[model samples]
Target: MVKLIALYRHPEDQESFDKHYEQVHTPLVEKMPGLKKLEVTRIQGAPMGGEAKYYLEAAMYFADRAALDAAMSSPEGKASAKDLMGFAGSLVTMMIGEVSREG
Candidate 1:
């Protein structure tokens, strides 16, 4: 399996970001051809009880790397990417990796 991990930093306006993410961005992500699952988490604090480095995390799961690549080149994927860059380009960091082991 392969996945794209997105780590979002604290936005200038949390309410607006949350609203747009839930209403708009999420739907766009759901349209991708090879998307198996989308898991999102809101980061609250570090283990030591202070602020965490990231505000949120999103994991987009795919069947494999080829599926991931195909999804990235799809029209739906292009739209989603545009939306992401329009809204959170500066505040988000994304990475792609394979799952070596999972339960």
Candidate 2:
């Protein structure tokens, strides 16, 4: 499976960011092709220094790298990606990567 990890920093106004995400970003990402599952989480606590490093995070799961790649190549993906700019101030870091295991 492959997952796109989107780490959003604390928004200038967190309330607005949460509202907008539910009203806009979530729906937009949900409509993208090859989206197996979509999860949004609020970051809390410290992964390492007893302090939280991020404000929000999202995990978009895909069937595999090919599906994820195809999604990124599609019109919806392209548009949704561009829409990310709308939340520029609320974004800290975003990354997409793959994971697999041998048995």
Candidate 3:
């Protein structure tokens, strides 16, 4: 399996970002092929107790890299790309994501 993790650095007004993610982004990605599971989390607390970095994190599970690539290249994928700009306009940083998983 492959797990894609996206680190979202959001605007200070998190409610707006969360709303966009739920109402717009999440659904677009959820339709991608090969996705076996999906999860989204709002980051909270700094274990190091300095500054909390990152606003939210999302994970998408795929059966394999090929499957993931197909999804990322599909119509849903194109829409996902367009949707990103909505939050990215307000974001400090947005990470593409790293994929990993255990068999």
* Per-model TM-score on C-alpha atoms: 0.97, 0.85, 0.81
Clash number for every model?
0, 0, 0
What would the per-residue lDDT of candidate 1 be over residues 1-103, giving only the tens digit for each residue?
Answer: 9999999999999999999999999999999998999999999899999999999999999999999999999999999999999999999999998999988
Rank order (by lDDT, best first): 1, 2, 3
Clash list (residue pairs), candidate 1: none
Arrange candidates by TM-score, descending.
Answer: 1, 2, 3
Output the worst ten-in-a-row residue range by lDDT, candidate 1. 94-103
Q: In candidate 2, which residue pairs get closer than 3 Å at backbone N, Cα or C atoms, i.e. clash?
A: none
**What value of lDDT does candidate 1 attain over all alpha carbons?**
0.97
lDDT for every model?
0.97, 0.81, 0.74
Cα error, residue 32 of model 2, in Å, equals 0.7
